[model samples]
Target: MEFTRPLPAYLVTRYHGWKATTYAENHAWYRRLADEGQRPRAMVISCCDSRVHVTSIFGADQGEFFIHRNIANLVPTYEPDGNHHGTSAALEYAVTALKVAHVIVLGHSNCGGVQGCLDMCQGRAPELEETSSFVGRWMDILKPGFEAVKDDPDMPRALEHEAVRVSLRNLMTFPFVKEAVEKGTLSLHGLWTDIGEGGLMHIDRRSGQFTVV
Candidate 1:
């Protein structure tokens, strides 16, 4: 499936502009971080959707947050499969090596991956005939959220928010995260960003609440 416009050429051209501006504007900060051996204090686990730009959405600085992205903003339970688990591996590094204070699962509205999972949960979508496709397996991570909130009238919205919550729940399955959370060294968060409406909600674990930020 190739496009007539061929985006690679446009992207390469854009990179030339970015290289000039970014290097001229921010290379010192990048060098300082390298000189100090610095790492970010937070880790953001977000969806791989192009519309949800985590850095720009949060107004982040260069070294502000360690990022891990995947479809549906998922974090699977710790599994030792032969295949590489990119998101989980990032989590392991962030928790153990980077020693990040906070780990946030950021979900967003109108996520196709979330929609697919909900459709499948409602039996409107089919089971995975090909167990090996990336999205087929990634959407499987949202099942617990659907099972938890399937009957709600706002099942779609609820599923999206609950996916963030359950992925936060799933984050605890990793031993380092579990230990860090228990000792109060690391805190977990569930966040939702509405791209269409332009609002962000933060989960208050203490009150079982989602407050606008």
Candidate 2:
């Protein structure tokens, strides 16, 4: 196969800047991570949106978080059918291998993927109903979330928060995760971030509401 596109000049310049600034300042820490291997304390599942900066939000450092990003940050039910499962694979590695103490499902405001699921559920996106659409199939995992919030006055925002709840429920479906939770070795948390105002909302397991944090 022949490649056509060249690297963007702006990205190349930014890489050089990082190498000289952040990389230089953290050189020893970077080398230690490379030699000692990563043992992140927490696993964070979040959206693939470029605007959702997980590190900046948590003020995390290198080797601090085991992160996984997917459409709507949704976790599907455990199928174990010997097929391609990215999210499940990450979860397994985080729990069984890395032994992350906490797993957080981070949803955000104005998520395009959640909006797509909402549109599909509302009969607006007919193409998403087809079998060939990858995104449509992936977003299907959030269908139950949309159903729960379909009648809400603010359907979009409600669905965004619901995605975190759905993911938290799905995390319990995995045997390893369930065992860890039961044994008090691991814990699950749900969070939603407002994009515009930068306010954080945490899901209260007791009240089932996304309360401001």
Candidate 3:
């Protein structure tokens, strides 16, 4: 197959610049990573939003995190019917293969996917109701979360936090994840960040409340 399109010029320039500067500065480190392979300690499931930088937030290095980005950072319940499952695949590799010690579901303020879910739940986004809309189908995973916080004064923010809880609950549905947790080899955490204020919150597993971190 012949591809007609070419990569954007600015990206090409940036790639060359990174190769000359950052990569050159860290040549030995990059070589070690390439030779040793990745041994990330944590698997961070975060949003696809451009604003939420998981590495920057944690001050993590290139090989420190196995990051997975998805709409609303949602994790669907385990369904191994032989169909395509991107997030599940990532989770399996992270838990069973990589043996990550921690799995963090990172939600953020002003999430577009969460807002879309709210709109769809409120009967506002008619297009999202269609079966053909991929985003709509994905957002369906968060509908239960919406139900829990639909009446909140700040439904969007509430649902954002609910998204993390929903994903954390869903993460347990995977047998490997559950087994790892039961074996004391793995732990799960839920976190939310305020994009505008650069604030962070951690969910208390016992009380299910998000407290400032």
Candidate 4:
């Protein structure tokens, strides 16, 4: 009986030492936080991309953040039109149920979904029905950003940043989000990260600069 296992070595090693690696002497803290209950001050909306984990990147331990991820990290405006609305539902819970103080959208470079929209714009990817299955449907959220940045030299990065900006705006469409902000209970933030440059940028509303901090 011959079988194949070509998984990455690090994954294998980590799994072999799961408990020790995951807790890493933080068992007490994890237990205490678990007992005290989740009082996470923020809910993060980020891409489902593997590299963009908010908890690991920020060194956030258990009970530190309420996180959500989706394709391209889009938060469509509230609608009663019978869509799945998974992201919207999660937003409602994090803001209204959890009463999070800050809602942050985390966008990043080299996003495949963003690049796909760019491909559609440049006429590389066809708009045929059922092509690339759900990808075409999912990337529709970035259509406006594609139109906005397709002419720029920095089209790629700019569109990614635009995604973050748009998501922040969409967050307000939820009544709870709006009320929280109106009453000074909630704030919106945007962030962009670069894997190539090893840089992180936070949004400045006045300047619209994603300055690294």
- Top lDDT model: 3
lDDT of 1: 0.86
**Candidate models: Cα lDDT each:** 0.86, 0.95, 0.96, 0.83
Q: Higher-lDDT candidate among 3 and 4? A: 3
* Candidate 2 per-residue lDDT over residues 1-213, each given as its tens digit: 477787799999999999999999999999999999999999999999999999999999999999999999999998899999999999999999999999999999999999999999999998999999999999999998888888999979999998999999999999999999999999999999998999899988799999999
Clashing pairs in 4: none
Worst ten in a row by lDDT for model 3: 1-10
- C-alpha TM-scores of all predictions: 0.89, 0.98, 0.98, 0.85
- TM-score (C-alpha) between model 3 and the true structure: 0.98
Task: State the lDDT of candidate 4 residue by residue for 1-213, as single tens digits.
Answer: 258668899997887796676676677888888788788889999999998878867898778789999877788877868878888888988988889999889888899878877787677888622556587876777787777767778878888888887788777888888999999989999998886776889998689878886
Question: Clash number for model 2?
Answer: 0
Q: In candidate 1, which residue pairs clash?
A: none
Point out where model 2 deviates above 4 Å: none
Displacement of residue 180 (Cα, Å) in model 3 is: 0.7
Model 4 whole-model lDDT (C-alpha atoms): 0.83
